[model samples]
Target: MSSDSTKPEEYLSKINEVRTLLGPLPEKSSEFCSDAAIARYLAARNGHVKKATKMLKETLKWRTQYKPEEIRWEEIAREAETGKIYRANYTDKYGRTVLVMRPSSQNTKSYKGQIRFLVYCMENAILNLSDSQEQMVWLIDFHGFNMSHISVKVSRETAHVLQEHYPERLGAAILYNPPKIFEPFYKMVKPFLEPKTCNKVKFVYSDDNLSKKVLEDLFDMEQLEVEFGGKNSDAGFSFEKYAERMREDDLKFFGNTTVTSASALLTNSDSEVSDSENKHLEDKEDEKIKNGTLESSLDTLEKPKPEA
Candidate 1:
């Protein structure tokens, strides 16, 4: 950690310092980089400019290659069919978006597809966030979970993608009703969780009133899903409806721009955007990041840059 102080002017100075260190970004790279985004990276790294720069650069590269923003709901619709994960219709007490995940609902065998769906959920959650909130809440139900559900590879990758690319975006992760047998699996995944992230994870059980109180403090029972002991009994996840919601959000995010859809465009089947037109749209998207209107974050500073 470079400094414990969090004074505003100083924080802005750090953002500028990181930008200077990063020098000029590639044309496509600036699409999501902003002062607020840089501040998140700095905060995650505890106010270190050099470390934040390196971390932010790596993320920029990942975003370019992975193109998380380009992944539309139509592409990952299959992975989400089982309702393994979806953005909850409700928000937490602080108005943060809530992402409901049920491991027992896993229906896919493709790890690659599973990861893509996770990223899609994450991006949707962020897109729906209010200007006042930068983080989202994760409500993971462990009902019917067993050893067969555990995948060490998926666990590590989840931790890496969230921590490395999303930086400080998790307000809290409620591991609700995990089985006693889940302890060993959790232990295996613990090493991949950074100390800061690990501290944000809460293990809540239905039998433990004190532990369950954590939920009461953070959520409205009426809005939370019934699986988590909440009042919402409409637990059914309709793939058609959820896909419709995601498509709506995607349209809002991309506006009239050409979206990279695996299936035909849901909004307008009659029209198609050409490659040159798509580039123009991307150029406009880059301007939004320069204007610092988009909400996104990255990594931090303090540690020495690793030897090349």
Candidate 2:
């Protein structure tokens, strides 16, 4: 963690260092290069300016070539048909977005497709984060899960993509009701998880009162699904409904970015603008997302699994 003094001037100075090191950033790189975004990368590297610069530069290259943000839901809709992964309709007690994943619901054989869908979900989750919240929670339901349902390669690749590109974006992940057979598989992938990432993962079982309390504390039982020991008992995921919500969010994201880009250009034109002034303006943009002006459809995103 950076010291308290690493704000305003010092923080913006580091951000500028990263920008200078990377030279000219790629197109559509504003959000990725924002003060908040750069600060996260720096923190992920424990405030090492050069290291953070390298990491952010690699991500910028990836974003330019891989185009993770540009991945449309329609391209990965088939991978989602089984409800393998989707943004949760609710946030945790801390107001962090939730992404619910079910391994047993795996319906695709293409590893590339699986990774693409995961990236899509990650990008969408970020788009939905509340202004003050920079992370998300992952609830992995293990009911009916078995060794056969596991894919070690995909697991490692998933860990790589997440830790490398989406630094500091995971607040916590709860592995609910994992069976004994899943232990070895977890052990295999454990090495792939950075200590920071591994610390956020917890194993909880319905039969264990203490572990079960983890969920109780993190979620409003009324909003959490019954499958996770919460009160909500609505019908599980509807692909058609979920797709509609994602498409709407995609439209909103593009629309909002256009206006934001324009605003950023106007603000950035003043060569003498102070760091505090730039931060103030960017904060206002973030507040709009939190206030639902350019918000994600996460509030109504579907959950659970037709496949599970």
lDDT of 1: 0.72
Model 2 pairs whose backbones collide: none
Q: Give the per-residue lDDT of model 1 (tens digit) for 174-234.
A: 9998987676546544544566677888999999999999999999989877778889887
Predicted model with the maximum TM-score: 1
Q: How close is candidate 2 to the true structure, as a TM-score?
A: 0.78
Candidate 1 regions exceeding 4 Å error are 1-10, 256-308
Decoy 1 TM-score against native: 0.80
Question: What tens-digit string does per-residue lDDT give for candidate 2 at 167-283?
Answer: 888888899999886665466445445666678889999999999999989999999998899889863577999988888888898653222212123222232243344445434
lDDT of each: 0.72, 0.72
Off by over 4 Å in 2: 1-12, 255-308
